[model samples]
Target: MRLSIFAAALAAFALTANTADAQTRVTYKSAKSGSSYYQMGVQIAEAMKAAGDISVTIEESQGSVQNVMEAAVRGGDYVFTAPPALVGAARAGKGPFEARPSPKFAEIRALFPIPSLTMHFVARADEGIESLADLEGKTILLGKGSFGADEGAKYMTLFGLDGKVTVADAELSNAVGALKNGQIDAFVTAGSFPAPNVIEAAAGTGVTVISLTDEQVAETGRARLVIPAGTYAGQDSDIVTTSLPVVAYTSTAMDDDTAYALTKTFWEQKAALGEAARWWNGVDAALLDNITGQIHPGALKYYDEAGIAVPDTAR
Candidate 1:
């Protein structure tokens, strides 16, 4: 009888170990480390772990454009993206995705929205550069190995200053140094208001946050956003610019139950996460209306229970 009891106990332990090993592990792909999206991804992972017996891993990625492609290719279980336009473009095989469009792009689904990353143009206060046109004939630093390079080039073309201005590529820190030393007349970047690099540059040298004129804003096809007065030192008045929404997304490979759990945990613990990151303060349920892709059925399940209407187009 004693031998039989010990054998049963060992079998039970093996079953328990197997159950733990079988738990689903989700991989979350976030942008560059130390970015707001990375921090937010960590928070989501923690919340999902706390609310359910699941494992989550955070992986650093290049940026939104790359993240969307990875999600389409099943490279990761979750991805964070911005502007929402990238999603539409990837699905329709246009813009950055024009070369090799993936039909898998249509299987991508939205999870939630994060804050908008505002586009900022910084120039030396002494330069007398007041608008996009003023960038003509000036040496501008378009961020190295970043989406800003393409965006800066586009801005110059849109404003008819393409051939006139000398565009240079440099990392953020090097660009800041060049800007402070008068080597570069303007620097273009995009991120949450009062971006750390912008603040550092402003503190080191007098800087002007350039604003887009009504016509430029209209021509760019981006939403106009404002950096409220005094967001940074020497920034005395509100600066108007364009912005893109950051959003969380997943692929169809994610099961409905897992999606439901993650979506539910995200909203329930958002306040707590917001406490850790100021950028998270801008996350709003209303922004769900801005999502350009389909809604995951599991996420839709929770939203339906909450009486939040997801557009039929997203279904």
Candidate 2:
């Protein structure tokens, strides 16, 4: 009887050890510290902890380009975020990826999309600023050292409005007040849809978000995004804009089970994630069409079971 009891205790102890050893660990590399994407890493780490036994460690990266470069040699358990375009560039050995072409670039597989960087051009509707051309005679604010400023300046030059429109020299922090008081005719900002600054500007003044025409979008050679109607106050129509898709990816070195669990947990917790941060609300399975590489076999399993269609290129 004592032997039987001893055997049962040994079995129980073994099970406990096995369970403890089952935890999966992943290293997630993304943007530089203090950026919104970096904060997303912290949020994702917390979500994984709350969901199950998986553990995620956040690592800071210079940017997406660096992320793709590192994936060339990083082994299993390494995950990172980057725009799908970079993956394509890496595969073709063009652009920044031209310097180094590794077969490992071919092994990169997509997991899922996070929030994108969407452009928003807030303009005073009362000033007859309904389109890009309308900005030709308007005074606009393009905050210094920002994506919006740079892009706005480029578009003005591209569309022949550079010398026509006057740029206000003001900090972005005061953009809303300046717009409300008519100090500036419009201002350009880029971020995820439902951008807070745009929201505040819309509510405070009769402002409209600019929609880039198909011709203009194509000319600019950037991805397109359409913000649904009713996304903001005083905006009753779709706002077409530019989008830079950000994606999560891993190398084939990671086994199917670990990738599957990670992908499954993400989709399952996406709603909760959106509740935590509004930017997450912009993510949807449809964005998978933008992923450049094939989907991870493990992540594909969850997509199939969940009835989410996979793009042929991604499969």
Candidate 3:
């Protein structure tokens, strides 16, 4: 009897040690520090860490494009980025990924979608730039080495402004200065409503928030969004524009069980997370429609068990 008791205790100790060792540690790559996306990433990491099954760390990055590339290269276990940006990079193998095509991009899978980010076109009110058409034959500032540049280039092409407007690449602050000094007529950017830079620019100078017409939105294949009146100073009316869905993704390197656990933990604790950040309130299983990449099998399994329909494309 004494020997059996001792043996049982030893087996229990080994089981506990093995269970602890099995906990997966993963690093989540987020956007620049102090940004909304970064805060969301922090909350997600905290949630996963609290689950007692996974250990998580957050790493700040330049932006969506950088996050996607880093996650694809094994630099991060998961990444947060705009779905359109990742889809575009993977499909064309151009832009920031121009040097070499990343066929591995196909292996990247979507996990969840955050709130949509609206595309904002800010132009000098004094420059007679009232609408997207006014941007023609003008010099525009697109963010240097970021998705803004890619979107700007695409917008110009879709709107038939290519060759009519000269595209200048610059950081947001520099671009604001150029607009103030009359160096650039307009600038293109995308983010959550009431973006700080747009607010600052509106406070400093008279500017018009250009809206895309319905036709333009359809042609661009972007969702239509409206920035409510008074979202920013000097903006007295609603601004109509297009939006892109931001999403969290992981590569195939993440095993099915780990992915399922992470996905289940996230959804199960989503209400708590939403309380942590208002933006998280927008995260729902329904928004998974915006995910353009393949869905991780683990996530699909979770949704399947929950009876949530998984799109054929994602599967």
Candidate 4:
């Protein structure tokens, strides 16, 4: 009798173990540790966990360029975020990916639109900073090895403030405290609006979000963005800037059902996500117009069921 009871208990344990192993597991790769994108990844993982039987592991990355480069080795259940332009560049074997083209680039597919990368040229308001040209003569921290650093540097050069400004080599995580302590006069960070660092800076100290003129905005050739007044503490008027449309993506290796479940959960929980953070509100079906590559069949299925039309360019 004792032996029969022990065998039955062992069988029950095996079934329980198998049941626990059935959850779908995915790896979500986003930006560095302190970034808003990284925080979003954490929130997404939690939301997906609560929604159903799925497990998402959050991974830190240097930037979108690195994320795209790794897609070849990390196909199945690997989700990464990048601007649509980067996706196009990777597919064309141009830009950063030009060094070595991979056929895997052909397998890249859009999962969903997250948020556009909005440019914020934050400065000390007490210093009377006002425009892109004002950035000249200021010390700015644009962090190394990041899309923001590269884009910020490019903008400075494009707007003709490159040589005039002193670019600090500090990591972006230190940007707020550096600005608060007067260690740096300003910093240029790129992320969705109401960027966490920007909010902290504004609340911690007197700061100004430099507004680009129509001509400056035109010269950059990025999408126009207006930061509504009161989005932060010290701002009283609209601040116009530019943005690069960003999207979450995966490869053909991720099975259709896994991709489908991920997409469905994202859309279904987006509203609640937005209620918790305004940045999520920036994403919408209309933003699909900015996508440059094919949409995952699983994600497309969800879009069709919801009546969201994806543009032909992304088909």
Name the top TM-score candidate. 2
How many residue pairs clash in each candidate at the backbone level? 0, 0, 0, 0
lDDT digits (tens) for residues 1-315 of candidate 3 = 999999999999999999988888877776788877787778888898777788777888887777767655683256455565565676578777777667777778777676677688999988888888898888899876555667777988887887888887567668778888888889988776666678778888878999778888899887777777877777889888887877778878788887888888888879988777655654567677766657889988999998887678889
Least well predicted 10-residue stretch by lDDT in candidate 3: 75-84
Give the alpha carbon lDDT tens digit for every residue of 103-213 in model 4: 998899999988788889999888888987887798999998766788898998898886899988789999999998898999988889878889999999989999999
- Return the clash pairs for model 2, or none: none
Comparing 2 with 4 on TM-score, the higher-scoring candidate is 2
Query: Any idea what lDDT model 2 has?
Result: 0.88
Q: Poorest 10 consecutive residues of model 2 by lDDT?
A: 188-197
What's the candidate order when arranged by decreasing lDDT? 4, 2, 1, 3
lDDT for each of the candidates? 0.80, 0.88, 0.78, 0.89
Candidate 2 per-residue lDDT over residues 1-315, each given as its tens digit: 999999999999999989878988899999889778898888898888899989999999988888999998798999999888888899899999888888889899999898888878889879878889989878899898866778878888989996898899998778999999989999988777678888898887978888989888889888878898888898889988887788999999999998999999998898999898877888898898888779999999999999999898788
Better-scoring candidate (lDDT), 3 or 4:
4
Candidate 4: deviation at residue 32, Å? 3.5
Which residue runs does candidate 4 get wrong by more than 4 Å? 134-145, 162-185
Please rank every candidate by TM-score, starting with the best: 2, 4, 1, 3
Candidate 2 local lDDT, residue 12:
100
User: Residues 28-121, candidate 1, lDDT per residue (tens digit)?
Assistant: 8867898866877788788778777667889898887888877666743565555577889999999989997888888888877777777889
